[model samples]
Target: MKIISFGVNNFRGITGGLENNTIEFNNSNTIFLLGQNNVGKSSFLKAYEFFYKNTSAAVEDIYRMNPENVIEFELVLQLDEFDFQKDSIANKKEGLKKWLNPDNLLKIKRVLKPKIGAKISFEKTENYTWDYEQNGWVAKNYGGIGLDTVFQAALPTPIFIKAMPTEAEGEAIINEILKQKANANLEDKDRLELKEAQAKIQELQDKLYNPESIQSYKEEVNKYFQSLFPNTKIELSEKDKTKWTENSIGKSFAIHFEQNNNGEKDETIPTSHERIGHGAVRSAIFSLLLMKDVAEEFERVDNRKDYIVLFEEPELFLHPKLMKQLRTLIYKVSETDTPYQVLCASHSPQMIDITKEKSSLVRMTKHNEGTRLFQINDEFLKDSKEIKTKEELKQEMNEILRFNPFICESFYADEVVLIEGPTEEIILRGYFNEVQIDKDIFIVNCGTVNNIPFFQKIFSRFNIKYHVICDSDAAEVKELDNYGLIPFETGIQKSIYQQLKSDYEKVDYSVGLFHVNVPTFEPSHQQESIKDNLKYSNNYLASDGKPYNENLYWKDVLKPNLNSEEINTVPIVKFLKNIVDHN
Candidate 1:
C-alpha cells in the first residue's frame, strides 16, 4: 500500500487541524524529503504508521515528545488493486440503500465498498482504545492481526531490523525455529519425516554458511565492535570466529576467523559481529530485514503492483561512500519485477546528489504556526546554461554557500552587483549615496573571491545581467580567468575604470568590471577614515582594515551620468531613449 496523503492534529509540535497535507509520490517510483534537522521528517513517517495502526501509543512520541500524550493522525493509502478488490465491502450508508439493486445487489454492493485489508496500530498499553473509525479501512479489518503480526506480515518486516536482538534472544529464536520444524514432522511415520527433518536442517545450515547470509552476519558482528573503538577496525583470529559461533549458535558449527592488525601483532580475538562496526550492524540489520520482506513479497505473489517505500534517513550510521552505494542499491531494488516507489529523507549532500528527476523533494521549515513542507520548485534546479557551462563550478559553489544562505538573501532583482567582500559592498553603497544615485540596484557581497566564479555561473544560468568587482590579487585574477572572467591584472582602481571604458566601447552587457588599488590610498587621509568606518560598522566586512580606492567609488562617478531615480532604472531608460532615437 502507498500512502497518498496524511493529516495531523494536536500531535505534539503539530497542533490544530492540519489536514489533506498530501505527499504525491513519483509516478516513476521515487520521492525525497530534503530538509534539515527537526522539520517533522521523522514525525511524517510516524504519522503514516499511526494512521495505519491507530493504537493508543503516543502519536506525539513519533515526534520528539512525551509518549503519554495523544495526537490524532489520519492517512490515505492506495493499496494494490487485488488487495483492494479483495477487501472491499459494499457501502452500507443509508443514502446508498436507494442505489443498491434488489437482485443480489446487496452481495455485489457489500463487496464494492473500499476494502479494509490490514489494520496495524501501535498502542501505548494493551487496553488502550484504538480509534478504528479514524484509521484507514485496511487497518479496521486487519486490526485482528496483532501489531507484531501486521508489521511482520503486511509491511516489510526488514523495515524494523534496526531493533537488535540480544545474544540470548538470537539463540532462542534459532532454537524455536528448529523446535517448530522438529515438532511439525515428529508424527511422520514414513521416510517423509526424515526428508523433512533433513530439509529443515539444511535450511538452518544454509542460513549459517550461505555466502550472503555469512556476509550479512559478519557485518553485524563488526558493527558491535566498532561502537567501542572509533576510527579503528577490530582484528579477529580464527579462534575468535570459533568463539562467536560457540557463543551465538554452538561449538558444533564449523566457523572460520582471520586476524590482522595495523602492522602490529593481533592481540584481540573479535567475533564476526565484533569485528564489524556498529554502523554496519545497524545498516545490515535494516538491509537484511528489507531483503527478507522482499523475499516474502516475492513468495506471496499476491500484490504485483508497484510499492512505495518511504525511508527516513537511510544514510544513518553510514560512511559517505557506503551511503552512495546504498543509493545505487535502492535504485537497483526499484528495478526489480515488483518495482518499488521510494521516498527518503537525508541530511547528506551525497544523498542529494543521488536524487533524479523522478524524485519529488520537499524542504521543511518551522514557522510560528507550525512546520511546513515546501516543494522544491524547478527554479532550485540550476538552469540549463549553468548546468552545461560550469557544473563543477556550481556544485562547489553550492557546497561553500550552503543552500540556505542564498535563500536568505535577495536574488530576485534584474540588475545585481556581485562584490568580493563586505568592505567593497559598504564602500560602493556610500559612494552611490555620495553621487545621489538610488540604492535600489541589488548589491550582493559574495563573501569571498573564491566564490565569484560560482555566482557568475549562477547569474549566467538565470540570464541575469550582473557585474562582479574584486581585488586584483594574483590568486583572484587566476581564479576569475578560470571562470572565463578576463582579468586586467593592474592596479585595482585603474583596471576597473579601464574595463568600464572598454565595455562602453563594446556595447555589450558583459563588458563591465571593478577593481581596487590599495597603494594609492595610503597617502589619502579620507581613505583611512573610510576604511576605519567600514571596518567598525559593517559586521559582514572582513576583519582586515583595507583602504578603499577609486573603484569603490564608481557609483559616485556614474550617478550624474544616469537620468533615473533607481540605479537599475538608468540602464532601462538608456535603452528606451536609444530605441526612440533609432525609430
Candidate 2:
C-alpha cells in the first residue's frame, strides 16, 4: 500500500480545515516539510504518529486545548493487486472488498474527541474507513479483528523520530530494528543452521527435564485450582517450538564501541551506549536505518509495504558533511527496492534537493486561521510547460542547486527576489539590507535571465510573492565572432520579457518585474562619472584580454556613485527598494 496523502484538522497546533491542511505525497517517496519555527511542521509529523498509534489524545492535543475541538486525521492510500494477494490479506479480496474504492484506493479517517470534567479522559476514537458502496465512511471491522490490527495490516507502520533525541532513544530504536531484522525470514543456509542449533538445545533441555518431578509439581498446583475450578487443570511442559526462536536470540543483541588511542594496539578503550555523545547516537541510529535499507536493496527480507518514517529535523546533531550524506541516504531509501517512504520536517537547506524527481517540498507558515502548507511544486509545472519541458526544468534546477544549494533558502522566505546574476543580487541585497531593515527578502541568482522564468514558475505555483529583475537585452546577439540580428517582436529576449510582463499583469497577488532597459546592468546607471569609471575599468581589463570584474564594478563604480546619503535617491537603488516594497 502506498500513502498518497494525508489530511489533518484540529490536531495540536493545526486548526485549519481539512482542505487547507491536506498534504499530498504527489507520487513521491521523499516529502520534505520546510518552514520557520512554530509553523506546525512538527505538528504534521506528530499527527501522522498519532494516526498510526491510535492512542488517546491528551487535553493539549486538541487545537487550542478546546474540549469542543475534534482532532481528525484522514489517510488516503493506494492499494495494488499485490496488496490483494493472499499473503497480504488472510481472507484475500473478501476481507478488504468493503474498504476499497473503485480505483482500489482506501481512505481511512480517525477522529478524537476530548471528554470534559474533573476526571478528564478521551472518548474512544473509532476508525472509519471509506465505504465505496455507501460513498461515505463506515466503521471498518473485519470479522473480529481489532481496529489496530486492521490498520497494521493495511498501512505501513509509522516510525516517528522526534527532535532532541537522547542516547536511550537511539538504543531503543536500534533494539526495535534488530528485532525486526530477526523476525524477518532468513536465508536457507542460516535457517538450517539456526534450526539445527535449536534442535540440539531442545535435546539437552529434554534430557535435563525430570518428568516425574514435573508431574508432582503439576499435581500440587492443580490441587488448589481444582478446589475452586475442578474443570480447569494446569500442565507444565518443556516445549521445543517456543524456545530459541530467532527473535529470542535477537534479544541478546547489544551495541558497543571500541576506541584505539594514538594507534597503539594495546591502548584500546571500550565505550558503552551511555558514554556516546548525543550526535554520535543519533548518527548511529540513522546509519543503522540506511544499512537496513541498503541490505534490503540486495535481499528483501519482508513483504511489508507499509513503512513510513516520520522524521523531525533529520539534520539535527550532525556536521555539514554528515547532513549531506544523510540527505543522500534519505533519497536512497526512497529509491531503493524496499517500500520505504520518508516524510521529513527539516530546517537545513542541505537536506533539500529540488533536483530529485521523487521529492516534494512543502513550506508551512502560521496564519490567523491556523498553519497553512505551501507545496512548492503543488501543480507540478502547471504554468511553464511551454517554456521548458519538465526534464529540462529539472536539469536546470539541478544544475542551479549544484552551483548554489543555498538557493533552497528561498523556499523558507516569505518573499523572494529572482535576479539574473550576482550583480543584480549583490546590488539589491546591499540596498535591501541597508534600507529595508525590518523586511527579510531573499535574493536568488538565477545564473542568467533565461532561468528566471523557471524559478518564477516554482514561486508562482507555491503562491509565493516574488519579484523578478533582469536586463532586457537589445534584440541582437553575438554568437562566437559573428553578430546576428534578433527581431524585437520575435526573439528570445522578447519572449522572456513578454512572459514576465504577462505574469506580472495577470497575477492578482503582489509581484514586480523590472528590466534594465540597457544591454546590461552597468549601463543602467545614468551617472556620467560612474559610467566613466566603468569605461576606465573595462579599458584597463581589455589590455589583459579579460572582462571587467563584476565585484569591481560594484565597489569602484557603483558604490562610489551612491554614498549613504544619496543611496535611496539613486534610480537603481530606488527601483530595487520598490521591488521589495511592492509586497
Candidate 3:
C-alpha cells in the first residue's frame, strides 16, 4: 500500500489557528513538498510517522494544545493484492475491503470527538458523523481493527532522515539489521536447534565441572559446605546456560570503524560514527536505506514490503554537485524493482527534480491566515509528454543541472522574480542591486515566453508569489519554443497574468505576470517603456573579441539615478519594486 492522500486537523502550526489541511499524493512518482520555513511540510511528514510509527500516541501527544480538544487525521491508501494477502494485513482487511471507495482506495480515519479523549487508535472511518461541539470527526466504528494490524507489519514502514546526526542514524540502522539477523538465527530450529544444543552443553558441563561417576556430587558438596559455613555454601552454576538465546546474542554485537594507512606495523586507529563528515554520513545512510528497502521487497515471498523514505532538507550539508547526485539517486531507487516511495520536504531546488511533471510536486505554505497546499493534477503530467519527447527532456534536464546552485537559488529566497531567458535574470539582478533595495528577491531564468507557466506553477505551489516578466514573442510565436500550454488550457492567454489568476484560486496574480508591452526583449525592450541606455553602454564597454557581460552596463550607473524617477531605469525598478511590495 502507498499513500494516496493525507489529511490533518487540530495539529500543530496548521491548526493552532488554521482550519483543515490535506495533501493528496501521486502514486509511482516522487512526492516533493515545496514550501518556505514554518509551513506544514514537516507537519505533514510527521503525520505519516505518527500514524505508522506511534499508532498508540497519547491523546495529549497529538493534540498537545488541549487533551480535551478533538483531533482528526485521515490517510487514503492505494492497495494491491499483496496488501490483502499478508497475515497482519488480512486481519485488518475485515470491514475495510468492502469500504474501498469507488476508486478502490482505502480511507482510514482517526478521530476523537465529543470526548473519547483517551489515546490514539484505529477506528473505521466508514460511518463517521461530524460533531459540531467538538469540531472533529466521530468515527462510527469505534474501537476496532479497521486498518490497525497493517502498521509496518503489512504496510510500508515510514522512516525519517532529517538534518541531524546522520552517521549515528546509519549506525543505529546497521545495528538493528544485525540484531534482526541474529534473532532469526537463534529462533530458526531447522537451521540450529538451540534447545538441543543447550542440553548438549549441559551434558558437557556435567562431565567437566561435575563428576558423573559420583552421581550426587553437587548435592553432597553443598551439604558439606553448608555444615562447614552456613551462609557460604557453594552450588555449581552452568556458565553457558543463556548463550543460545536470541536476546543474549543480540546484545553481544557492536560496530566499530578502524583504519591504518601506513604500511608499517602501526596500531589501528579506532573511531566512532562522529568522525565522518555530514555529507558522507547522510549519503551512507541514504544508500543503506535504498539497499535495504530493495532487498526487503525482493526477499519477501508472500507480500512485497513497500518502504517510504522521508528526507527533510536533504541538501543541508551537501554541495550543489552532491545534491544533484542525491536527487538522481532518489528517483533511481524508486524506479527500481523494489517497492519504494520517497518523500522530500525541501527548500532547495537542487534537491528537487524540476523537469519532472508537477504531479510529483506538492506545495505547502503557512501564514497567520492559514496553511494551504496544492498539487498538480495528472492532466498536466500527461500534457507534458506531448510537449517534450523523452530524449529532449533528458537533455534539457542535464543542462539545467549544470547550474544547479543558480537555478535552485529561488527556493531559498523570500521572493522570486521569474523572467524569460538569462538576459532578463541578469538585467533584473543588476537592476535590483543598482537601486540598492536590500531584499531576498531571486530572479529565475524561465528560458522562454512559452515556458512562463511551467515555473509560475512551481512558485505558486510553494506559496511563493512570483512576478513573471516575459517578452511578447507574438511576432516570433510560430518560431518560439512551446511550453506554457497545458492540456486543460485551450490556448495561450493574451495576458498570462489574468490567465494565472483565473487558473489558481490561491494567488492574486494582478501584478504577478508582467509582459513587456513590446515585440521582443532585446532592441524592443531598449526602445520601449524603460529605454535603457545600458544597452548602448554595453556596446561601448566591449572592445576585445570576448562577449559583453550582461551585468557590465550597470557598473558605472549610480544608485541615486537608478532610484530617481526622472532617470531612465526608474520604470524597471518601480516595476520590480511593485511586484515585491504587492506580495
Residue-level lDDT of model 3, residues 102-177, one tens digit each, is 4546555766443343644434324342333355445645322234444445556666776785444555654444
Could you estimate the TM-score for every candidate? 0.42, 0.77, 0.71
Question: By TM-score, who's the top model here?
Answer: 2
Backbone clash total for model 2 is: 1
Worst 10 residues of 1 by lDDT: 106-115
Of candidate 2, the 10-residue stretch with the lowest lDDT total is 478-487
Over the stretch 1-583, how does candidate 1's per-residue lDDT look in tens digits?
4434445644545443453234554243455565546666666655554444543443334333533333544433333433323222212233323322332121100010111225323433321112333322322332222233322233321121123433333333333323222232233342353354543544443443445543544454445333323334432222223222312432122222244466443547655655555455544333422332222333223332333455667767777667766666555444434345566666654655322444445554454555655443223444412453334535644554562244213333445676766545555655455544432355667676555555554444333455665555542333344324445554443344444444435432343343333322222212433333222223213344453433333334333434433433222223223322321
How many clashes in each structure? 27, 1, 0
Question: lDDT tens string, model 2, 242-353?
Answer: 3466435433224444343343322233366566455555545554455443235324323444578888898887778767767877777677465678899998888887
Better of 2 and 3 by TM-score: 2
TM-score of model 1 relative to the true fold?
Answer: 0.42
* Cα misplacement distance, residue 246 of candidate 2 (Å): 13
Q: How many clashing pairs does model 1 include?
A: 27
- Higher-ranked by TM-score: 1 or 3: 3
Residue 3 local lDDT, model 2: 87
Q: Global lDDT for candidate 3?
A: 0.54
Cα deviation at 216, candidate 1, in Å, is 11
